[model samples]
Target chain A: MSHNTEVLDQKTLWGGGRSPFNVSYGKLMIWFFLISDALTFSGLLCSYGFMRHKFSDTWPSANDVFVHFPFMGDAHVPLLYVGLMTFILILSSVTMVLAVEAGHRRNKKEVQIWLALTIVGGFFFLFSQVWEWAHFIHGTEAGAIKDIIVDGEWVTQVVHGANLHHNEYGNVLFGDFFFFITGFHGFHVFSGVVINIIILIKVMKGHMDKTGHYEMVEKTGLYWHFVDLVWVFVFTFFYLV
Target chain B: MERDDIIEYSLDISHTDEEGKVIRKRLWKVFWILLAVTIFEVGMGFMFAGVAAYKDMLMYTFIFLTVVKAGYIVMIFMHLGDEMSYLKKIILIPYCFFIAYLLFIAISEANFIFDIGWVLG
Candidate 1:
């Protein structure tokens, strides 16, 4: 513990006390937290693979599991919708970088405007996620449903909601893990939006330039980008893989 | 503090233009690199997507590329690359270990549970 304390104490003054590693306290913590959180996510995805290997025969494919959009009422596009989501997220990350750049130039208005745009992008991403979850839960009327007994209660499940065989995308465990992983990731993006909002608020109120610091913005940019990075993995593993 | 040394915390990074539109040249270069990398990823995604050969291998390769691209964006674009290599190593090497450890434990435990379900139940 003493050694640990010493390590932290030594690092507490990094970046000549100006940078403190890219941004400030909020973002620094977010990065460290995200690294560990990212590890957790990697673990979850790794388990997904293990389970997939065991169920190689009957296990549903990713393309079949998430085929259609909710309320679209027509058409099955395998990667089309997810590809769009990826586009939105990547664009938002670009805007976040722009916001950080604007801050670096000391252009408050530009920074504020860019931040607002990023927030809009974040909200759009969240809305899409909500729809995805809703589709996962309720499924479509066209697909076959399953009844499984849980604790003396009968529960309904979607069996191949995306395909003709009507094989459940996963067993109860499948549904459980899917919800756990994706939902957790979505929550991170949601919380990130919340943080961006707070940062935007602080910028608008003129708090950053006062102390001769926009490390806050820089740090937040790191976090926002990290969120985007994790999604790339999610896309590859959950969708593309 | 001297004017030059006094870090203006304001949003104004402009040293030349009156409107404060100035930006570092490196930002554009980084943006272009990121875009190029994204295009490559999309290409790989489409290419391997239809073919069944080495699906796992392709996915792992893409993941490795993503990690590389993300690290570059953080290091070069974000200027962590400019810092002493020692510091960069300090931050990154441990996180790699953690990811591996988490991957092993989580996957093995999950498989273990699934196995027990089959044998005992």
Candidate 2:
């Protein structure tokens, strides 16, 4: 009886070697973490969607709500600044991927340059978010969205500035949601920037070069991209929709 | 001398490779695709604003475009497109279902609240 005795490589279906998923353990773990993080953001956004839908008629329009332009003194520019912030964040994501590609080739200098630009981009985004948060809290000249009797008729009231309890935009709930969601997202971006700075220092110091690979950069790139991805959804659900 | 027999050592500044070209091209392509989509979304937002008749249609469109942009970012930038099929499925399947479940529950509850007229009424 002839026996089939061909030895299978460790990569074979039954044989386990190094990376069954065809990716490193670090990358796989990052993917898992990101998936969970995504669920959290989705929950928050869905809640926003639900509230807005229920108050479709009474909800403040994004156009009338987010019309502040920096240094323009009450010009109704609509989504211009937020749109620019979005573009900058997207550009930063592009730079991050470029850094990852450079890392794959073990090009340390390219990695450093790209990473620095990415950090700058991250800082810019963070600053923009802070400005936005401040503007949101300070609101337009009108005030918190409330009910006021005008000429013996009850009508919607617009006020200036907002806190956890009061909102100058539309509904107090709108202010609450805005602060919680955007603040949460901004914190993520801040963490990403901190991580990138750490990685940037490592690259500049040639630490990654001694390791013979740039997997750390790639791993961080995965995270930064995930942050960018979340912002896309947030911008839509909050700013556009 | 056979070209395939030559061993390549990647330096900090070396830019010579056939494979690198392909990757760079793909990177540029992804950047352009993302930029184009953002511009398109902005244009649509401007066009459809203030038109009461198109409110529902606008919401659906925004959601669709947002999904498209998110897909491209995940697939390309996150390198999921280059990963194995099983790995992709392992990550994507659960995520899609979970988000859908959340949306379903949240929307239903919001509608219930609306019907009860507790907050607004």
TM-score of chain B of each: 0.61, 0.80
Residues B14-114, candidate 1: write the lDDT tens digits.
23333324344555566566666666665666555657786777777777767776775667545456444544675678977877786677667657766
> B15-113 in candidate 2: lDDT tens per residue?
345766787898889888888888877777777787889878888888898899889898888888867667889999988987888889888988888
Off by over 4 Å in 2: A1-11, A144-158, B1-16
TM-score, prediction 2: 0.87
Top model number, lDDT? 2
In candidate 1 chain A, where is summed lDDT lowest over 10 consecutive residues?
A: A1-10
lDDT of 1 by residue, A1-241 (tens): 0012223344554646444333334544656776777677777777777776455454555666676765677576566667667778877887887787777667789889989999999999999987776667666566566775557787886453322222356455556666777778888889889999999999999998786656677777877887887787777767766
> Model 2 captures what fraction of native contacts?
0.51
TM-score per prediction, in order, is: 0.75, 0.87
**Model 2: per-residue Cα lDDT at residue A171:** 65
Determine which window of 10 residues in candidate 2 chain A has minimal summed lDDT: A1-10
The clash numbers for all candidates, in the given order, read: 11, 7
lDDT of 2: 0.80
- For each candidate, report its DockQ versus the true two-chain complex: 0.25, 0.32
Give the alpha-carbon lDDT of every model: 0.67, 0.80
